[model samples]
Target: MSSEQRVLHTPDPAERENLATFLSRALRLDQAAVVRLRKRGSSLVSAWVATGFETLAVRTITAELGVDDVTVGADTVLAGLRTGHPVDLGYSMDSAWRGALPPMDGFAHVDDVPARALVELAERGADLAREHGGVHGPPASLLDQSVLTVTGADDLEVQVPMRVVFALTAMDFIPHAGEKAEARRIQPTELVRVRATRTWLRLDARYGSVARRLGGGIPLSPS
Candidate 1:
């Protein structure tokens, strides 16, 4: 890591808040989580973290990272974002990241599911999880269960797992019911995109994205 790369600046001054919120949320999910910041083009950077359900949560914000990529403790980055200073991100944890990122393109938009519907599904799943959860939390069967299936043009079909919905709501990607809003949490027309590559299934929510590989982190691709 170079001195210049340690510096973080939002493309539009307000984006720092979004980046900080992202890191903080990721940190809460995994206390020891490391954040992967990959610079995209000259104006955007994508920050990703494993959401502990074998899915990756990603948020892209405008920024200048000075380097193409770097990994740092999400907690540290959160603090840096809050303090508005050049943070000592410490050592690069590029090696700590253990999986492949999905292709930037090549995803076919299989279908669109109403955000409100998915939120309802997540609520029901949460209730079930609490009723059946043990020392390890929700059972793999429940989380892995396919809750919805979409078949689009060309006979394309995608089965969305409960885990994707869980990850989305857990990250506050789509505001939940109890969460108050001037209007509805998600508008009736607001939809979460369900896209797929041969190897990945992606859910693009308003705030961020939750991806499970057709099958892993980003379980939802075959590893």
Candidate 2:
């Protein structure tokens, strides 16, 4: 068997700003307009956002804006785009992300911005967006009132009620350094739920999108 090891890279202040620039160009938003983000419980929750506007543009923008570390796949996407290749902006996000991983604080300083970073950021953003699916299509909205059921083999089912008001879909789930191994999925319509005691009558997962896109934009099914 031919197996390879994956090594992770740490994101520095320069790279973080570069990523922000790439994201701004990729999403066609001003860098000043974009907000720096931190991952909420392994994934970037929508509540962490300043606005209720939920789109892959928002999600991926936040994902790349992360300062702690960058995913190899994301780097590859950026590199490919820089070289002018087809890329897919499509990725997946998961609930219960911090269920197993260690706690990590926010990226670097909040207000830090590097000079001459937009050029590299734009280049990387174009490279990464080449084959990304969400770049062309409408972005995924945040889940309003979704039910995540835990149905194991032998017809054992446990439904968890959840309410997700602010959250990203796929893009945010990519650079979650922790829980990568245990983060497995099964059924398209199935997902793990995160309910808010502060808010009532809310669901964060979707069966319709899963049915339409299959594994593409479907919810996460736990292992």
Candidate 3:
């Protein structure tokens, strides 16, 4: 809980750059955003941010953070990384995260959808938003509509909102049409995994994951 900026280390340049990209996306979504860093174990740290669309985004990377959990300003960490400044994450915003982190375990495997499918859905959502949105952006009905529903074992079904898809693309979680020709040429048939608990629904993409409240009991099954 130090007011002073704290330092950490990520020796691998690739991982550091990836983290930088995630933080930058978060800042772009909400300029006053904060990133919560939670050590997953001895090797990886989960960096989480609240996507402005009622969802949470996380990108876990390997690093030596020396601590278990802390929250800091996204812009501060991004600046430190850009300037080679020892990842001096400034001003512990421990209280900034106002919601509970999803449980690391116990999520039921609901289904898997193609990454390309998700990318396409996001694109269509954007077009619809642009056509109908105004000063306040897309209408709540569009954002909250159940655009997709996947059924799973034990009679489980969940509806995915356009806002979730928007958050996914906004965070650059899934690969899409804008990749370089070289990257597009080798785009793998990666799948976006869907999982859920009684309280939340999560979509895991190539780069990160986005989750939001289910607004009802999951599974729609008997207890």
Candidate 4:
């Protein structure tokens, strides 16, 4: 399959409920009340529905785990550019989404392929949402992301390079009514943080083995 043709599944009821509960707890809102609020006209499943909110979550999670800044691959960069969207990769769900970026200037840059792919995704998502007038059907959607990063080494003093994936979704938990025309489409974007100790150098030897073992890197050859 083409890299741009990534599959993003819908969220199940259980997933929605978990997200709702998590939001309620994080925002200190009553679970039942939160659910009700979510069901209200023009609403979001979680208070963290804003586009930037996801980016914030990514940065925070990465830092907390003591991982360096995240980097985007050529595919990601190209995807975003093509689709007018930004996102984390598929493997992120299992790998904790923290070590996605490869270190560079204390931050990570988007890979060419994914950046362009996002542009197409953005267009598709926006078009789809526009068609429904901002009402997503029963099942919610997801967008996964994989990133590259540089890790700190204990003895060699050479930062170990790595790639990680963080998955994201573009979902409409509750169908909102009277939402502004702009609110119908969720724009794709990215947030990069600086705090690593390496520069641009695809040390595939160093990271390739680790990525393969960790199940994060894309298969060099299609299966």
Off by over 4 Å in 1: 86-88, 175-184, 216-223
What TM value does model 4 have?
A: 0.19
- Across 65-146, the per-residue lDDT of candidate 4 in tens digits comes to 1112222232332232233232222222222223233321232322222222322444455455456533432113322222
Candidate 2 vs candidate 4, lDDT winner:
2
lDDT, each prediction = 0.82, 0.26, 0.81, 0.25
Q: Residue 23, candidate 2: how far off, in angstroms?
A: 4.9
Clashing residue pairs in candidate 3 are none
Q: Give the winner by lDDT: 1 or 3.
A: 1
- Report the CA-based lDDT of candidate 1 relative to the real structure: 0.82
Q: How close is candidate 2 to the true structure, as a TM-score?
A: 0.22
The TM-scores, one per candidate, come to 0.90, 0.22, 0.87, 0.19
Top lDDT prediction, candidate number: 1
**How much is the lDDT of residue 197 in candidate 3?**
88
Model 2: worst 10 consecutive residues (lDDT sum):
207-216
Per-residue lDDT of candidate 1, residues 104-209 (tens digit) = 7899999888998888898899889999999999999999999999888999999899998888877888754565421256678888899998888999988899
Model 3 has an lDDT value of: 0.81
Worst 10 residues of 3 by lDDT: 214-223
- Estimate, for each residue in 1-223, the C-alpha lDDT of model 3 and write its tens digit: 5544256678788888999999999998899999988888888988989897888899999886756788889988888777754687766887667777777878899999877676677778888989999999999889888888988999899889888888887898865554521224325687889999878899998889998878721232321
Sort the predicted structures by TM-score, highest score first.
Answer: 1, 3, 2, 4
Candidate 4: stretches off by over 4 Å: 1-56, 60-112, 133-223
